[model samples]
Target chain A: MSIQIWTFILVGITFAIYLSIAWMSRVRDTRGFYVAGGGVPALANGMATAADWMSAASFISMAGLISFMGYTGCVYLMGWTGGYVLLALLLAPYLRKFGKFTVPDFVGDRYYSDGARVVALVCAIFASLTYVAGQMRGVGIVFSRFLEVDVNTGVIIGMIIVFIYAGLGGMKGITWTQVAQYCVLILAFLIPAVAISIKITGHFIPQIGFGGVISEGANAGRYLLDTLNAISADLGFDQYTQAFGPNSKSMLDVAAITLALMVGTAGLPHVIIRFYTVPSVKAARLSAGYALLFIAILYTTAPSVAVFARYNMIDTLNNVAYEQAPSWFKNWEKTGLIAWVDKNGDGKMEYRAGKAIEGKPKLTGQTGIYGQALVSNKVVDSNANELYVDRDIMVLANPEIADLPAWVIALVAAGGLAAALSTASGLLLVIASSISHDLYYRIINRSASEKQRLLLGRIMIGVAVCAAGYFGINPPGFVAQVVAFAFGLAASSFFPILVLGIFWKRASKEGAITGMVLGIGFTMLYIIQTKFLGVGNWFFGISPEGIGTVGMILNFAATVLVSLVTKAPPQDIQDMVESIRTPRGAGLATDH
Target chain B: MENQDRLKEYWRRNLRLMLVLLAIWAVVSYGFSIVFVQALNKIHLGGFPLGFWFAQQGSIYTFVGLIFVYVWRMRRLDREYDVHE
Candidate 1:
């Protein structure tokens, strides 16, 4: 079968399974809609959490980023996985014990103030929207490339499918569908990795193959990292297998970025809410462990994939004659993602370092200025023979680059779609619950009936989906960049407040509110100035990605300073904190 | 008075365990991977530089192990304090 037909068949089958699950598990009450009735089993909830956590960034863009950035990319791998440790030990079980329907529930009740709840609601909605926009864009990219449709049409199709499952089934439906998504995405990620590993190192395991010596090729008997390092040096890039020091990304920047990602993962309302779906506090703790184990399966494999994909691209394209290029090269070129200019009129492509030459001859009525076959539109640079290859193509084009079979490429398309859809549904649920449960039921209509709240939740999901789809069509940045901003905002605004509310009994409503406002305010201002305004030189040499760590520090300082001056929380609130610290009476949501 | 002391003791032990485990997490991810990375790079493990392996692969495996260890110890602690859920 053709690759396009196979993609359609696999994607169609997966969508059908998701829709059926959504139909069967249709939510009946506010509890089901908001928290999946708080009855999801540990293993199943673990799978759901893994799916919810690994968004399009993890599935599609992470390996690509790692391939280009090399060792500096370790910040993402360590930061993301390490956060689960904090969640399992410091946050998850405690939140499950204090559980209501949403993150705001804890903030509101713990501080004994509706003011704090509103702050948390706003943060949750803001962070989740930023994250979900990236997921929607990812879905559109996969659809447009594989299904041969325009980007907007592809986005609309994805929005419709997510609306069906998320709007109808709520958390209950989303949970089951996520379990299926985890299976598809993991298999899709692994098959290519394993195949390439065996091809390179004669090993079945990618982890071992990463460090094994290549058994064939010109680099035979040479260690994989040794070969990659030599190739990178020849291309004027840093070694692929060494840590960044004074010459590259600073140690402080690495430390700051890693910390920000860890805290941000713990703070994300969508991921934290996954813990509330489990039946018991013990299950919440155990489920985090299971979730990490599941997430690790992919996290560990990504670096290997990055190394192999980098090697393949360099090996195939370096110094090759333009006319002798492979079919895959031409296919990617038509999409405008790969461009080359024969500056010396040598009729050969040069893949090297430094800036491409500028202002070459136009291709209107001219021929043979460079080559008879090469046109101006195909060559972006005129003066120098430079090749521009987009980093995002690394993973999507990996199978073809390795000459893997067509069916494997089709499976990758399905996997990318599954990843984006599952995460989009999860984030939309958080946004919907924050509006319907926190803003509407709790504050606006304190006496709203269960049916009214359920109806409102569904309505909010529809509206949120439309907004996310619009952003996907006009994405502000790349998939991983937008996600990094989401993480930064979440780390700054929610993480410090949540930690203080539980761990410090004297934390007051005034302090929490002040802390959240200042934290989010500072982080947003930094991101806007640097990202959109093109401002150079961040404060203290920290990148915008690591500025959230500074914001978090300011938040903690503000909270602590404010709380010391203010009166302590009420006796009941203090006692509530004490009870949440223990594991007893955790399954039931009671206020003692 | 006796019940209050037992509850206090349980909470204290839990906090102590958390402190100890979190310390390990920090040392592996931040300390080995970043702060001491240059020093560790002098040593090679298989085909990987020691610090590079810790940053990219070893830290993740340690995180997974840390979580399971926390769960197992917490379960036993809960039972000892009659707080098992």
Candidate 2:
């Protein structure tokens, strides 16, 4: 069969698997709808969580970001995984003990206020929309490339698949389906990478290959690190080992970004909801550990892909002329993802560093100074000056660049779709829960029956998926930039409230409300100004990246100061705090 | 009631172990990798910069280690709590 035909069959098989799973696990009660009947095994839940968490960003964009950023890309590698540790240690078990179906449910009950729940609901929606945008786009990209369809058509098809399973099966279906997706996406990611690594480094293991000595260097036994750094510097970029800018800001930026991602990942409603699918507090904790282990498999290998792609890229075009650039180069150039300008009207291209120093005025972003334009204007002489590489194309292009089989390329397409669809489905689940559980069942119709609540949840999932699909078409900006806003909202709102509720006996409802309002309010204002209004240049000296860090500080201060001013949490609430922290009664936590 | 007390105590021990592991987590990612990366990069590990390894490989190994520790300890804790499956 043709590659396209086979790819279609693969997608059909996966979709059928999802639908059948959802069909078999149809909701019999509200409990099954919201928390998957609370019966998922710890290991299965872990795998599902990994699938839900990895998303399009992890599957498609991350390895690409690392490919060019070299060592700097390690920030994402460390930050994302470290955040899971924070989730497992600080958040998951207690939240599980709270025995809620949604993130807003926890916030509402723990703070003993509906207003706090509303704030949490709003934050969850905001973060979910921003995140879902990327996943929808990821779905579109995979469809556009392999399925020979427009992004919008792809999104519609993706939305249908999500609606069929996610809306019908609820948490139960999503949980098991995510496990299947985890297998598909991981095998898809690893097979090509392992093949490429062995071919290039002559080492069978990717991790060891990344560390092994360069085979043909002047220093034949030179370490991979030294060789790569020299190559990066030769290309006019900073050495892979060298630090950028002043020490203080770099430290602050790294800390701020890492903290934002950590707290944000832990606080995200979609991720938090996964914990609810487990049977007990201990199961929640174990699921988190499993999720981290599953995630680590991808995180560890992503760096290897990055290093390998960079080396392969540099070697391919090192001395080749613009006219002789490969077919992939020309194809990518048409997409504006990889551009080569013939500065000075020269027929050839020059890949040297000092060339960019001559022509253009450097752009000063609202934040600190961007490094000198990485691209030089000089036409590369037979040597391509600098490749204008877009970060989004990295993961998609890696397999093709490695000369992997066409079936492998098709599998990568399936993997990317799986990653996108899995996260999108998870986010849609959160959106549904917040509406059906927190808003409808809790406030709007407290007396509603299980069937009504389940119906509402399904309707909400469809609406959320459609809204997200619209935004995916006209993405607000780069995938990372848009997702950072989600991080900021998460850092500011959910993290502070959840932490204080669990750890501090003195924390009050008034304080929790104040913290969430100010935290989310400040973060929203900053993101709106910087990304939408273009007002970042006027007020703060820095960009939107640093706003979450500031907002987190504000959240903490507001929560503390208000708690001191207001009445302490009631004795009962304080007792609840003690119980969640104590971790006793792991199996006996009540639905009440 | 005594089973509840044992379960609570089991939880307390689990929390204690997490705190220690988390401290190591902070030191590796924030302390060595981000805050003092340049200084550590000045030192070498197997010809690779120490900070680079910490950022790319070292922190991940620590994460995996923390997970196994948590799982092993928690299983025993479950047994102590009389909640073992």
Best by lDDT: 1
Residue pairs in clash, model 1: none
TM-score of 2: 0.90
Global Cα lDDT for candidate 2: 0.77
Candidate 2 segments exceeding 4 Å error: A216-221, A245-249, A330-335, A344-349, A352-386, A474-480, A533-543, A582-592, B1-15, B77-85
lDDT of 1 at A129: 93
After aligning candidate 2 to the native by TM-score, how far in Å is the CA of B59 from where it should be?
0.6
TM-score of each: 0.95, 0.90
Error of 2 at A19 (Å): 2.4
User: Taking the candidates in order, what DockQ does each have?
Assistant: 0.87, 0.52
Q: For residues A1-592, could you state the per-residue lDDT of candidate 1 as single tens digits?
A: 8889999999999999999999999999888888898999999999999999998889998988898778899999998899999999989999998878889889889878999999899989988998899889889989988889998888999999999999999999999999999999999999988888888887889988888888887888998888998988777777786677334677788888899999999999999999989989899999999999999999999999998887777777777877677777777765555666666667777776554433432334333433333335544443343676666677788777767888888989999999999999999999998998889888888888888888999999999999899999998645456665788888998899889988899888888888888988898888778877889737877788888898899888899889999999999998888888887877644222
Q: Which candidate number has the best DockQ?
A: 1
